[model samples]
Target: MRSDLQIQQDVQDELQWDAILKAAEIGVSVKNGIVTLSGTVDSYSKKIAAEEAVKRVKDVRAVAVDLAVVFPGTIDHKSDSSLASVALDALKWTSFVPEERIHLQVDNGNITLEGELEWQYQRDAAFNAVKNLQGVRSVINKLRIKPGPSAHIIKDNIWKALTRDANIEAKNIIVETRDRTIVLKGKVRSWSERSDVERAVWSTPGVLAVQDELTVSL
Candidate 1:
């Protein structure tokens, strides 16, 4: 296992290497295996980029983001009505999102979405549509999956999907589903592979949440 200092160094290096975020705007700290990111960014997208960069580093067990979004005064802040109008327009143009069913709520700079979609990807698509908008400070995605199939069927489908994935050692994985939540318990050779397993689970039609208890054995 890598020491906390090395892990902190790696995270700092990762922040610098990522082109989307200005490394100087964000701060990094590590304790045990957890990384905490602090500072302020002009946009919510940059905040997300910072967190993703931290996860890409090896030996990072978890991430805590203490970053705040403080846009510059030169950029005129949009009214809540303006934000909602723009968000609706963006969703209308996004092919994956069913804009007709989704509702957008904006307060100050925070965004809240509520509705039901057929797939997780569609919900994600809706979120991606507005997250990078000019005045968005934060996003609270409460979009849900419309009932399509049974939970037992979802569990079986997930098992098959896990087995079909070339990157995952399917035999070492155990999958359990309760309603829309999936509980994954297993071991994988690398962190990338473990993430792959969860990604596959998310791609499935009925998965609302994933409890990843996968250990990196390498």
Candidate 2:
């Protein structure tokens, strides 16, 4: 196991390596295996990028993102109405997002997406559409997946998918289904693999939510 100080240094280095983030704008601290990122970034996308960078470092157990988005003075801030219009346009252009079924609200540059879609990927696509908008400070995704038929088969399908995935050791994982939600319990070799397992679970047709209880065996 890596020490807290080593994890902190690697996280900082990882943030510095990411091209989208200004490394100096983010502060890194590690306690045990948990990393806390604080400071301010110019865009919401960069804030997401910083957290992702920390996740990529070896031995990082979990991440707490406390970064704030503060746009530079030179960039003109858009009024809430204008930001809403721009976000609508962006959603309309995203092919994966079903804009007709989704409703959004923009308040002081923070965007909230609320509606229901058939798949988790569509909900994710809708969030991605507005997160990079120039004036967006944060995005809250309240979008939900419409429940699919035959909940009985969800667990089996997810297990098959997990077994087929090259990155996951399916034998080490247990898949449990409660209605439309998947509860994953097991151990994964790394943070990335844990994410991979969750992503696979979400891609299944009947899955509406995932409760990931998988621990990384560092």
Candidate 3:
């Protein structure tokens, strides 16, 4: 196991390595295996980038992001209405996002997405549609996934996908379903494999939610 100080140093280095983030504007701290990132970035995308960078580091068990988005004065500030229009337009252009089913609200550069969609990917698409807008400070995804298919079918499909993916060790994993929700339990060798397992579960047609109980043994 890596020491907290070592984890902190690795997270800071990872942040510096990510081209999207200004490393000097971010503060990194670690407690046990949890990494907390604080400071400010110019865009919500950068904030997310910093978190991803930290997650890529070894021995990191969790991340708490406290970064704020502060746009520089050089850029023209957009009114809430203008930002809403642009966000809506972006959603309309995104083929995967059902703009009609999703509703958007912008308040002080914070975008909120609320509504319902049939698949987890569609809900994710709606958030991606507005996350990088010029004045967006943060995105709040309140979009719910509409339940689809039966629990048994959903669980079976997830198991098939997990077993088929060479990156995941399906035998070590257990799949349970509560309605449209997938409950994953077991262990994986690394965070990447854990993510792969979760991704596979989300891609199943009827999954509305996932309870990821897998632990990283490495």
Q: Pick the candidate with the highest lDDT.
A: 2
Return the lDDT, model 3, position 213. 91
lDDT of 2 by residue, 11-94 (tens): 888888898888987899999899999999999999999988988999888899999999999999999999999999999999
Q: List the residue pairs that clash in candidate 3.
A: none
Off by over 4 Å in 2: none
* TM-score: model 1 vs. ground truth: 0.93
* Residue-level error in angstroms, candidate 2, position 69: 0.9
**lDDT tens string, model 1, 1-218?**
99999999999998999888889888898998889999999999999989888878888877899999999989999999999999999999999999999988999989999998888889889999999999999999999877657889888888889888898899999898877788989787766788789888888877778889887663
The alpha-carbon root-mean-square deviation between model 1 and the true structure, to one decimal in Å, is 1.7
Cα shift from native, residue 122, model 1 (Å): 0.4
Q: What is every candidate's alpha-carbon RMSD to the true fold?
A: 1.7, 1.0, 1.5
Write down the lDDT of every candidate, Cα atoms only: 0.89, 0.90, 0.89
The residue-level lDDT of candidate 2 at 97 comes to 85
The candidate that achieves the highest TM-score relative to the unseen native structure: 2
Report lDDT (Cα) of residue 125, candidate 1.
Answer: 95
